[model samples]
Target: MTQKTENTQSGYWFSKIPSKNWSEKFFLYWSLVWITVFSLIVATEAYKVFYDVEFFILGLFVSLPCVVIPYFFPCAADKDKPLWDRYWVKANVWIALFGFVGNYFWTHYFFVLLGATYKFPVDFRLNEVPVFLYFVTHAYFISYHSATTPILRRYWTAFGGKKSTLKTIGSVVIVFAMAYFTAFMEAWTMEKVPYYSIQDRERMYTIGSAFYMIYFIISFPMYARIDETGPQKNEKWSLSRTAIDSLASAMIVFCLCDFWRLIIGSIINPTNSIPFLGTHGIKA
Candidate 1:
């Protein structure tokens, strides 16, 4: 019974490294692969690779691998379970969904608040974002969360392995630091990409990272507990519960993001806009 209890609790937060299954390992490796591929594309200024292809087609090329791979990769935790029923695969799909939704709605905050610009070859857009970017964001979020998990686990252990007030404080500090680091890295890496631009690069790196960290601040920890400890002790989350939790995380971030816009406005924009009741502030 004790061993069964441990088995049920074994997941992202409960374990130091959560790649206990083939699907989990694949998620991590493919995330690295996507990051590497896009980094090279940016470093090489491979604009033709994107521009030559139809935006919709390119979107498919990026998206299909994420959808197709997990269904085939069986989880070691429960080989008898169907592929999609595994925890990591469900987590991947939901995170990818967040990526797509985030690009549609959350990105406009960057455009309005930080004076960011997208120089896409096509005019096709959803909520002022290039359509291909939705797919790109999907891949990026997978990579980001994949990288976030282990590091957070290590930090959580380092600070204190037990539940206590100090550990809680340490967890908050670690989360903020990790969130800020990842957000800044995201800005730094894509700075070379010609299609994406932000006004006042320095401010974007500094102040804008704090603003962007809001996304991970909510998402990172929320995602860690998806399959462990739910309505009942040691009970695994069902697909519906996994999705609901994922959507709840994104929605919380969405609300916090808009709240930032309403209360803080843009410090990165040259105009130094004041906060207002709208999605973005007007130049003062």
Candidate 2:
């Protein structure tokens, strides 16, 4: 078998020449369309928040794009291949499952422990998750694994000099920095939308961001190994393998987030909350 050479220019912004297959073209086009639509929703939310205006329909538009934007990036396994190709399909499935389950734990369960809860006025729920929020969560994972991580890795490898230790240290720093920014933006947006409320806003913002930082520390490195475009891409794809990897990633993130909850919950509100279990009572 001939050795596969990766495109040196491939990163967040560019991939190799896009597949000319009609199905692939259609998928890419619609992905861009949905991303634009979602951006509009985000923009509407921003306008309402900035102008201090209230609109009953605003919630409907707030989160749907977040789900679609992440899918816009091409999968590593088949960057220039048809959408129906086994690698593309399997990789997307892995990412979707990982995003959905991981987000559920962090958004629904973990946030409650930190004295925060999502307030979606539209009230669409699937098994107790807000439907729009589910999409938003999936989008977050897609964006990170597909786009952000690659870009960060490229730069870290470039700037960290020839030493492996420097590369390792730089990767960690980059991961933490990216995670912190993501968490900070999440906190800021929650505050802006008035979608979530916290008992101690200032402390939660700081601590919650750190909790996410730990999550990325584990996720970024793990993804680098399992990504379809990574070392395992040449291996035959299988449902069993995808399921196992996705479950493992979700479990790792869940445990890490909960571990932080345990440690932080004990210090912040041990009287009402159990360590590792999170805070008591649902927020109104």
Candidate 3:
């Protein structure tokens, strides 16, 4: 339980004792809306002003899991099981890492392709941090779906065997397209904001989007498996599965992604060259 303290004389907000389930309140519909929908809007708008086509492409791949994932995989928690178990926690962590770590590979390569001699002056090691951070920060999208996925288990359950497969495939396409559209919108945003500049970053964005689609198509089966397992309250290992809780878990994962980058950045890119997630994350 969390503990809270108060000074009778001088007023000061203090510690709060852990309510039986307060720590996990984040894994609900409210949390998902807060994190995912709004993020999509802001990211969409930001990309439009800041990076245009780059954002559109990024948005497309991101949409696949964001949509298909939550609809299919249901959570293991309910009124009977008040507190989040280990599996939920673990699931969240993994999805976040999956996106963050995965992107590192592409982002670094993009930098190499980018001539550091430009006005931006990218150092191979330093510039590459943004690529890694980009992936890590974006990983939260998957996490949000993970949490929300549980809520929609009943809906997907209605569709069985052939229908379910059809729905899943169709969904992948829809999300992929919607995400891409957003990417395009974001690309437009880049024209205005101009957060980044160079020659072929647009191409890099396209490549990244393609990678996301390929990865999502391949990963669908695994996500389906998670759906099959549904929510298992008794399962002690469950809460740790941060991959399970789409919303709250994703936000938590987002936090971890940054933490992971921070730890790595301390060693590799201390100059805050990571772009969106530099020394002053989401700031400069």
lDDT of 1 at 107: 76
lDDT by residue (tens digit), candidate 1, 1-284: 57544443442333422332354456677777666766676678766566525656756666567767655554455457765466666776678767866787777778777767677777676666777778777777766776676666655555433577887887799789989998999898778776777778898899889889999999888876666457763366777777788888889998998788877787664455544333353221
How big is the positional error of residue 51 in model 2, measured in Å on the Cα after superposition?
21
TM-score of each: 0.82, 0.67, 0.40
The lDDT of model 3 is: 0.38
Rank by lDDT, highest first. Answer: 1, 2, 3
**Model 1: clashing residue pairs?**
none
Which candidate number would show the highest TM-score if scored against the true structure? 1
TM-score between candidate 1 and the true structure: 0.82
Please report how far candidate 3 places residue 233 from its true position, in Å.
13
**What does candidate 3's lDDT look like per residue over 63-177, in tens digits?**
3343234334433333244334333334444455555544544333223322111122222233334332343235444443443343233234434322556767766665456
**Winning model by lDDT:** 1
* Residue 17's lDDT in candidate 3: 16
Candidate 3: which stretches are off by over 4 Å?
1-88, 112-127, 130-158, 161-172, 178-195, 201-208, 218-227, 230-284
Which regions of candidate 1 fall more than 4 Å away from where they truly are? 1-20, 52-58, 76-79, 155-161, 269-284
Model 1 residue 217 CA deviation in Å? 0.4
